[model samples]
Target chain A: MMLPGFPDAAPLAGLGGGILIGLAAALMLLGAGRIAGVSGIASRALGISDSGMSKSSAWMFIIGLPLGAFIVAVWSGGLDAKFAGTGALIAAGLLVGIGTRLGSGCTSGHGVCGVSRLSQRSVVATVTFMAAGIATVAIMNAMGLEVLQ
Target chain B: MIARYLPPLLSGTLFGGGLALGGMTNPARVRGFLDIFGNWDPTLAFVMGGAVIVMAIAWRIQARLAHPLFAPKFALPTRTDLTPKLIGGSALFGIGWGVAGLCPGPAVAALVIEPASAATFVAAMIAGMGIVRLIEKD
Candidate 1:
């Protein structure tokens, strides 16, 4: 089913995917007793951060991410993606890395896990990031910076 | 060892697959969702909503569990203070997310799908993280 005004929106697919993500996170929490936050996991895997999980275990999870995506891409024909120019990507990546570290989480950690549990910090962080993202996009659009191709 | 490692591997796979299937692997789609003022797409809201709903149930379940089935304990975050670092870092992350329409999860998931671009982003992101580490050391 399509959204009334947003013809491009795939609500069902989004919901299905969301459910799958939720299950993935649930598995992490219930099975391993961890929050499946990609940024934190990546840091731990790289030995940049300390965590209860082993480095090898962290690598396994990180590696599994692309493996799963590859499976879906293969089964679904292919995945389509677009990215900004190298300069923008580098700048953005830097900001993301630093910000997530300082903030202590990213979308998966704070947005999903934190928000679901009604954690005050996560809620505030989510709102702040959302607002910032919206504002950034708006400002970029105003300036005619066509980063998305 | 298998028991210790398998769960996270499975979790990551499911998470990555969900990201791909949810249309989040596509940067344009993510940017579209963020483009609230322009031609906005609400697909991400559904994804977030669905994930949050399921996770909310998981949290409820967590309250009753003595420990994680595979691990010794649940190592969740406990800090509650709202600090400048949190707000500033999140805001910076938001700007970056808006700039590229890619977050860590999708960026990592896209490693196989868009090798060159994803690699570039990931490499830069790692460097960004390194910068934070350096600054924190001072």
Candidate 2:
């Protein structure tokens, strides 16, 4: 069913997708004994930062990200995505990268994996980020400076 | 060596697929969820709920196992101290996410979905991280 005011939201798809994500994370934890924090992994892979995991393993997982997304996009007959302008994208990317590095995790690590495992730091980080995101959006909307179309 | 890498590869693949299917690859959808003040979208909530529930069970299973299947020890975060760095960084991340509706995972996954846009973002993100690394070297 549709949510109250969201005409284009897909709850079912979201849940199903989330299950897959959880399963994937579980596999990483049980099989490799690691939290599948994408930022940490990606940063390590790029040789930008070192979080202890071997660069080989990091690259392996990083490559798999696009591979899996490509498979899904092809199978689903293409996915729809709307990006912000180039300037906004660059600025946002820079902020996300710096912030996640300083915070030590992002949505995947802190939001999904951290919260589920009841990590106090992850919980706090997730709450803080979500609150910040909500406030940012609210403020942007008020200022009529919505970046995404 | 291959054995050590295979699990992560497979997991990453599934993670990417899930992100795509859950519409996390779509900035509009993610922004909709963040826009709680505007036309709020509850779909992303379901995504987070589903993932968290499953992972919660996974954590339970993990507690019983002495060691991981492929690794010698469970390599998990043990830091508990909450610092200004953590809070401040997260706030910056939230602002970025709010502005662009793009996070690390989705941004990387979108490399295939939208190569040019993803490339630009990834490049800038890497540079940002590099800047942090440089500053931290002090």
Candidate 3:
């Protein structure tokens, strides 16, 4: 179907973006011998240092994500960013932390790398994760929590 | 390995600030942006444009770097095609993004900037991932 954002793009841009993500992930694996899996990297950053190799790489990867995001904020220019409140952000962070632990990977891991590799796990995880996101938003919207509104 | 992260660090910070500017740091803002045409929020497009531009620059820089800080070069995928998996996963992702206004990357980014919904979204996202993994085993 048609996606709301980039309605003109339809399948082309998303698919193109997906391909690029896959390409980047694959390159990381081949060149640096990394998975480009954000979850593993992020989780390891918090803990789970079975080996220094996995742990260190994970930390860098986790750090890279926000770093990339921060640079984007400044270059684009915006009036100071705002948020719902401290409670929500912290609660959200904890949930995400736990979720990554239980899931074994996040969207980057399963959605990007796992899907790229055609791993069955990625397929299932991606669908489930995405669906959950949809469901959560719907319920939250209905509950009148109305974030961003 | 540590050296390899230098690029990501440089890129990630830029990405973060851009998200803040694009309002991606706010899921509500992103959701509103997606509601464009419905209400005409052209804000997200700028973020998309900005990001695409940054990506273009990174692509060029990476290509020129002889040593890429820690590796020879990026590895690309061998397969040059798509399958049922691509279609299904993308469809699911689209619905999620439409509803929550947070894709995985931005969702994680929002988490960092501190949003309550992002945390819930990520939690549900992980639970969803776990369930999928279990089913796949069977």
Candidate 4:
């Protein structure tokens, strides 16, 4: 189904995808006894950070992320996506890396896993990010800066 | 050894598939969701809602289990303190996310979907993480 203002929005796909993500996270939590926080895993894998999970385990999970995407691509016939310019991508990436590490989580860790478990910090983090994201978009639009192509 | 790695591999695959199907890997769609005051899309809300509902059930199951299926003990966060660092960092992350509409999960997944762009973002993000690691040590 399409959203009111957004013609390209795919609610069914979003819901289906979300359920898959939830199941994956739940599997991680129940099977591995850990949170599927990508940034934490990535850092640990890269030797930049050391969390409780072993680096090998971290690498295993990290590898799975792209592999999973590949399966979907083959099944669904790939995505037609565009990215920001190199400079913008680099700038944004740097912020995301630092911010997620400092904040202790991101969309999956905080938004999906945290809120579901009713963790106060996760809830607060999720709200803060949402608010900030909205404000940033608003300001950028006002300035007539189209970051996305 | 296989058990140690297999679960996460499967989970990661599922997670990646979800990101792609949900359109989270698409930067424009993500930016559109962030554009709350503009032509906002509620699709992300549905994605979050679906995942949260399933995860809520998982939490309940987690509470009942003695230990995880493949692990000795649950390795989850226990900190509850609200700190300036947390808020400030999250705010920074939000801005970055808004600017590029890509986060760690989608960015990693995008490595295969859109190699060059994803690689660029990943490399920069890792550098940023390295810088933070240095700052924390000092």
Binned by DockQ into CAPRI classes (incorrect, acceptable, medium, high), candidate 1 is: high
What TM-score do all the candidates reach, one by one?
A: 0.98, 0.97, 0.55, 0.97
Residue A148 deviation, candidate 4, in Å? 2.1
Worst 10 residues of 3 chain A by lDDT: A8-17
Winner by TM-score: 1
Tens-place lDDT digits, model 2, residues A1-149:
66665678898999999998999999989998988899889889988886657899888888988888999999999999998889989999999999999998899999999999889899999999999999988898899995764
Which model, 1 or 4, shows the larger DockQ? 1
Better of 1 and 2 by TM-score: 1
For each candidate, the DockQ is 0.88, 0.85, 0.14, 0.86
- Which 10 residues in a row give candidate 2 chain A its minimum summed lDDT? A1-10
Model 3 reaches what TM-score against the true structure? 0.55
Tens digit of per-residue lDDT, candidate 1, span A12-119? 989998998999999999988888889999999998887657788789889988988999999999977888889999999999999999988899999999999999
The better-scoring model by lDDT among 1 and 2 is: 1
Give the alpha carbon lDDT tens digit for every residue of B1-138 in model 2.
Answer: 679778889999999999999999888889889998778888889889999999999999999999999889998999999999999989999988988899999999999998988888888888878888899989
Off by over 4 Å in 1: none
lDDT of 2: 0.90
Give fnat, all candidates. Answer: 0.86, 0.84, 0.14, 0.84
* Inter-residue clash pairs, candidate 2: none
Question: What is the C-alpha lDDT profile of model 1 across B86-116, one tens digit per residue?
Answer: 9999999999999999999999999999988
TM-score of chain B of each: 0.98, 0.96, 0.76, 0.97
Q: Write one digit per residue (lDDT tens) for candidate 3, span B1-47.
A: 44656544433343344344445556565555555333434455544
Ranking by DockQ: 1, 4, 2, 3
